[model samples]
Target: MDCLSLLEHVIVTLFLAVLISIYMNKGREEFFRILLLGLKSLPGMQGLISRVLKGEVTNFVKQVNLDETTKGGKRPPRVVIPKKGIPYDELREAMAKFKAAETNHVEGKIFAYTYTLFDEHFQLQKDCFKIFGEKAGYSENHDALVSLFHQAFLHENALNPMIYPSLRRFETEVVSMAAAMLNGNENATGFLTSGGTESVLMAVKTYRDRARKLFPHIKEPNIVAPITIHPVMEKAAHYFGLKVYHAPVGPDFRVDVQAMEKLITPNTILLASSAPQFCHGIVDPIDKVSELAVRRGLPLHIDACFGGFMLPWVEKLGYSVPDWDFRVPGVTSISADIHKYGYVVKGASVVMYRNEELRKHQIFTYAEWPGGLYGSPSMAGTRPGGNIAASWAAMRALGEEGYMSKAKELMEATIKLKDGIRKIPALEIIGEPCMTCFAAQSTDPEVDILAVSDVMETKGYKMEKQQKPSSLHFSILPHHVPFVEPLLQDLAKSCDEVKANKTLAKKGSAAMYGMVATIPDKAIINDFIVEFFSEVYKCN
Candidate 1:
């Protein structure tokens, strides 16, 4: 189209949008209420909208000290600090007030944080924080404290570990620990990265880079992964300019190994599987995929980020999990997160390979630079010392015995939660999930699972929702073991409330999710999410 026509189109669009905005603002109360009501009228939108609204209303009620009606409130939610620096004592008082305000949002109160906070353990962690935090904060050498205490002890960046001997040692130890956990032999070698996503990206990058080097005939590099593989692989493929081939999963939610085998082609560089996928927590058949990778001379990666730390202990505790780690013959690499189940502070994960030669492809090096020769093993250049230190501290504190015991408790809690959900006549658990994470689908198609989620939220339980099958999810933790009975009881009561009084669950984020799913144009939904992210970082 001509520039004139394009300008005319833009003006018309703007005019209509302004009219809609004015209408919406004029009927603001009606607009929001109806928007939520419309979402609840749809299936999955009810769950998402319900969660969001519950969060907003709960905060409103607490901050304003309002009753159920929210009438005649003295204070608003906004409380700002002074622009100028306060005296240390005044600052401490302000910090205490803020901490008190946040303390109300503690463990067993909500979900989504994922970490289990036991009363005794929470106190222990708090005390530990108080002790280590002050000293660490006051330390002269930022790098020295980090190097002394952290699990990944090296202060030097992994990008050019050769420049720093201590960092190289830390990196090697972390990788060795991960490989040993995965049943890798002497030949196995690996690298440390930021998190699970980076590990997955490097695996894709390594395979893609290797394909270009070895197979001159292959024009386009393609990766075949089960639908359950973390979205990171797909994202890496998009960013790195490679094609991704998805293999379907069985009703059990595990990857269909035969289907993946058939899909393998000359262009396929990496075969991917999750030890236990995110959605349903079902482990893919890595043995079959490993064999295929061997026959096809393709690299295979096992993503165990979710279940990594827990699974090792669970196996020791006597769970019949299949071999989905480095023990499997043709598996070239594995990615496992220490932060999640390892009870590490955060920002810790390990990516392992069969040999250092395979890992060399994952590294980025530069010989010519004004800043001198630069090389990084993973994505980030400057790593956080505090995170590394805290993670290492946490791991040492937990030890093998602590992890195993915690894993046992978590498994028991998961089983109890599963059983409780099964008893609810309206819902059916999706599959045999071996780990803490389990998903549920509504049997009565008319009754939205999101609606059930809304009811649960009012009772102070925050559950996650899922797409594709339209379900609600749970990720069990050690602290949850104590509250399993209460949680299950609440869930049962919520289910009853949902069935009897549909209006009770009629308000929240559930509505938004349901509405989004039914919308035929996914591009619009994607655009909305992207815009949401953009608006989040925009200056107020």
Candidate 2:
């Protein structure tokens, strides 16, 4: 065998040996768990897992939606109008009933939706959708059903961007907007991605590719980020074959720059800090990280998918926002989601680099394919034109002035709520969020935050609960701003009511969340997640 072939074989052998060693060291259970996680990272394995998860999630939704004891028990007509259409009024009544059932299921009841609950904001969104929905997808070039669908199709096949020029255009605009928001200049360039996860994936991939080209001798690539950095980085590391070195966070939930500095090694491809992490809405030390990256010749990525669109305005409105953008010298790339705070529909996000040179690492090229020569700037095969249009529309509609007003309203409401929550002795605000989204925990040992969340669920708040600290999350939207005081008042009352009341029977999906958190074996949790997907896809 040639030297290169022999070297590859040796590397594969070493990889296998390492796996075996880990399996031996950690025992079969832990080893298999990690191995399965590793398997899930593989492209083939990822697709399989995704399908399974989708199916399970679908089935779960069906079951919950059709639960006989609940209000939405009546199923839709099975055989879809095989005979003839019903009368107009009859059809309208049926539609209304169905709408009511769905509304009952969602109205002030679901926390995960992250929209305004029956307020002007909610009405405004509906009005926007109503006004735009019919006309939204009517582009002759691409007859998209929804604006989201259009965006979904913009580059649905990014593997062949030449075939879909619109995707390139959409991507270009998205990146330019993201970079401008992050203070990137003419030197900056970027691409559109599926979501925050894919954006993170591409950033890691780009850095790895750059490392491969520049420092070929460095075999092992590692990413350094705070513990609070979204798990997507870990997912990216796993998918692209890189190691993760976590830096600890302070009580304020911000990354410790000193600890991060100590963790950087010769193989470190990327340094990361969050504009504001998912769990707690606290921005990391981006300026410090950027300075460090510059000194070390490492590429630093600021993940602002959660806070990118909001923070800029927040900073402009005179909040204590830090320089977590391209303004920093070494800040190489940034990921921002137009879907989240951008108030556009989902399936839109951007990954931007400080300069074209660094961005070159993000492009994928293929010289050989049966169909044709293929190349893509981002990960996806196809892009969505409607989403791009909708996002662009959303941006245009909500210009700087509009966003500033929204930011101001949201900040005021958030501060009021934070102060109100702090007044309650049992519950404490998790961190000082610059914007609306924040987390809270129960200080009283007897009071389970999950239980409190369950109680809030009963009250129709539908807040999300978290583990690893056992807290509840709240993403305050512009819609929720007005209800902030009332929500806090209800929350305080809920705590009192729960404290005074008897232990009632557990009802609804809150129990499942609690159960998931308590499971000691992570494999079982994985199995449950897999099973959950299996259940989701069940039609009956």
Candidate 3:
């Protein structure tokens, strides 16, 4: 090899390395994440490192195991298909056994997820499911009742109105109902999504595409949102190739409107705030943020996924709820989860827009295919009909009167719970919650919030723990109404017990959460989460 050739090779290599570093540094957090992941993938290195840190790794694994067992006893059977099919009766028995191992959310033993109503209402939902089990909206050959139920399912192919006219009608009506509830005018239109995440994703995608069309010269798009905005928005930005600039919140846990506005730039395509954000159950200053959005000529998205179904009724019942929905003039879109507060079976959410023109950006169409053209309304191509049908049935069965009554009960329970927490000297509510969900942080240094959570779990109350200022979250559902007093009593006892022995924080899930919160290197936390998900998906 010649000296000149070697010199040129070195120069090119160094130049490429510099360019790669610059590209990665553009998004430093994600860049470090990818770098760590690449290093972990090196052959034999990860295992060798794990062996070297055996003691630390083993303690983390033990904590994971303890947390899993504390949540629900032993793991369920990981069964593969049998060589020959089993009888239906045997399969049913096995299924029942597996289900028996889970925490009974119906009895209010669980708290974080799984919303339910009175037994009769639940039975009605079950009956509806049974009645429509064999039906699919893809076909038109069914009885009138089944056809009516089938209307709820909107297929991706339904973009061609001729294909599934009923689907279009059902979806339109659903969006209209949601829009009216949120105080949207006649121009409002949207489509039903599988869940809240997809709804938020669609909104992000819409705004990104809108920017691409209107500001073609802009190289990168960004969204300015409150730090408390649902993590789904972050996921959306990651998936759609956009950046998120999170604005700091105030001590009240609501978005600081001034801070959010200052983050907006020419490349900012969307501004977002949550209606009672999931962490602390405090609504951001939507009205104030809307003013900024209007002035900046940017689209604003209100994420009401957690509070949408309940807030209007709460306000109707005389609670002073903030302006968070379509009623706000500058609010361009809103995402609401029907499954959460609507008391419907899972996999149902609504995403609404102020006008059809904005919704056009959400729709996708592909032509020039050999098999003809294709179009999809949301992310998924073939969505489950049962989710939509069951949601419709649940909503219809629980009419406005039923929902209002339930909301009243939930609010009353929330009041009692908040009052109870306030009574505890060691704990304090994170903020003035606008809805039934709220978090309680430890006020006394001796009372570890995570330890309190562990004790609450032992008492058979499933409590969700949060970070960034450690706290325990509660979502008071109708099922929880009966158990509110008991929960408070247990919580009080737990606080006292934890305060008595600060070392309790060194054990079980408390220790794990403490480690996660205090860890400076988030890459390790990310790896832990990835590993935990891998464990969840393992069959054996």
Question: Each prediction's Cα lDDT score?
Answer: 0.71, 0.72, 0.77
Which of the predicted structures, 2 or 3, would earn the higher lDDT when compared with the native?
3
| Candidate 2 residue-wise lDDT, 370-476, digit = tens | 96666777777555555665554455445577677778888888788888888988899887676667889889865666667767777888788787687888887
Which parts of model 1 have CA positions greater than 4 angstroms off? 1-164, 391-393, 503-507
TM-score of 2: 0.69
TM-score of each: 0.70, 0.69, 0.72
Candidate 2: regions farther than 4 A off: 1-167, 501-524
Taking the tens digit of each residue's C-alpha lDDT, what string does model 3 give over 129-225?
4434555432322122233343323212333433333344445555766777888877887888989999999999999998898899877899999
Best by lDDT: 3
